[model samples]
Target: MAVRSYFLDCASLRDYLQGIWHEVAYDGLNSVVAGALVQLAFGVVKQTESDVFADFPGQVSYETLERIITRGNTQKAEKEFSAARHALVPDDQSQESDEAFVDLKEYMLSDAYRNLVDFIVDYQKNRNGFPTMKMLMHTTPWDPGFDLQQATKEERLEWRRVYTINWLYVTW
Candidate 1:
């Protein structure tokens, strides 16, 4: 389901995420297991080869985007998303630390990582909303756990380097 996927509206994306997260969290997977699954699912995630949604319009619907992101792998994506959130920001203290990425006003000002965050935001703005990590993860297509381990160091780093803080879209 990685090669191609349909864009989605918001409700569908949220449902997808909630469903997957519930399943993964149901068994209380350990941090190690959860983290591994997140890497696996996000790996298969991909952008459309071409912009089929591009046209004279405001933005893609959230439900449409959900399908686009999940690429039919809601289970894997949501599980990993929940795992990553738990790993990266397990508590209030961890959340503070994670903020360091977007904490730097310079990064936000320079737009260094804004493009990536904007991708999801701009689409969600259509319906006056934003997607949570779990929502986005469930909706997005991603790799399996083993492939994440097999990827090159650079590939893994690139995946990890994404601005999760920015994904939160908080402007202070």
Candidate 2:
């Protein structure tokens, strides 16, 4: 079978993000679980489609989406890093730290993110299936020094939702 790619408009993506952000952000476990369940419902839409759909006006390709994501991530990371740097203690009358921090942009755009996107797209388009639990676990990203076994319940849930959000972002 010929492989196909999904495309969506910027407005649609923005609106979807807003909705999910509203639903999932800072409410409670119930809200987060609701978001996860809604994401599963989202999978149903993906599963029902079996055609090579034509691109629509204002719809962006994956490359376009990648650029958009990169731009947004860069801006957010910059603001966050700037805030963090300013919050740090002054060293020898200098506000800026002599020590260098990890590049936020590079970390945000790391291969893990790309691999997760690739895995989802391939599973949906070429295999016409969802990833197994093992595949999902391996592909999902965690903090560099995070220890899953030592994490609290909330931490586990937060980490679990990150991948769900990424899947919904790409596949929705």
Candidate 3:
């Protein structure tokens, strides 16, 4: 019997977010912010795929299996992201040390990130289901645990970088 297939491609997810970003204008939101949020969402989905499909056998394709098995690559990407995120702030002062010294870039990025998540939730709620691959390449349900509200400047920056890497990997 032929195996049933369902997969989410990074390139497709990036494109979908790009489209939404273009059409919708959330306060203080832009393409870069949208891209970063999309990356976080992608990571959340990818990280949870195992549990999401635990009950189903042979549902995940070989390509997905290969991607999942390369845990080292994912970890490396995340570490690179973390470094880039930390580099956004001053070395002399930590982000937590000075709430007054608000990094406008980080603030804007975080707000946009939260707004995007709310948008997705609303979209799903209205549709009464998760989007299909054709509608949006999201494979797993949107995880509420992926919150960036209290995330430090470095963490937010890391999420952006991760998305950027995913975008490049998918496009090229």
Q: Per-residue lDDT of 1-172 in model 3, one digit per residue for the tens?
A: 0111212343345457767686557555666777787788678657556554674467664444434433335444333222223323655754433223333223224344543554455456546443334334322333446568888766655555445433433353
lDDT of each: 0.41, 0.49, 0.46
TM-scores of the candidates are: 0.23, 0.28, 0.24
Better of 1 and 2 by lDDT: 2
In terms of lDDT, the poorest run of 10 residues in model 2 is 1-10
Q: Which ten residues in a row have the lowest lDDT in candidate 3?
A: 1-10
Per TM-score, the best of the predicted structures is 2
Question: Top lDDT: which candidate number?
Answer: 2
Output the better candidate (2/3) by TM-score. 2
- Give the per-residue lDDT digits (tens) of candidate 1, residues 61-97: 4334444444555544444332113234445454322
In angstroms, the error of model 1 at 153 is 41
Candidate 3 displacement at residue 59 in angstroms? 3.8
Q: How many backbone clashes does candidate 3 have?
A: 0
Model 1, CA-based lDDT = 0.41
Please give me the total number of clashing residue pairs in predicted model 2.
Answer: 0
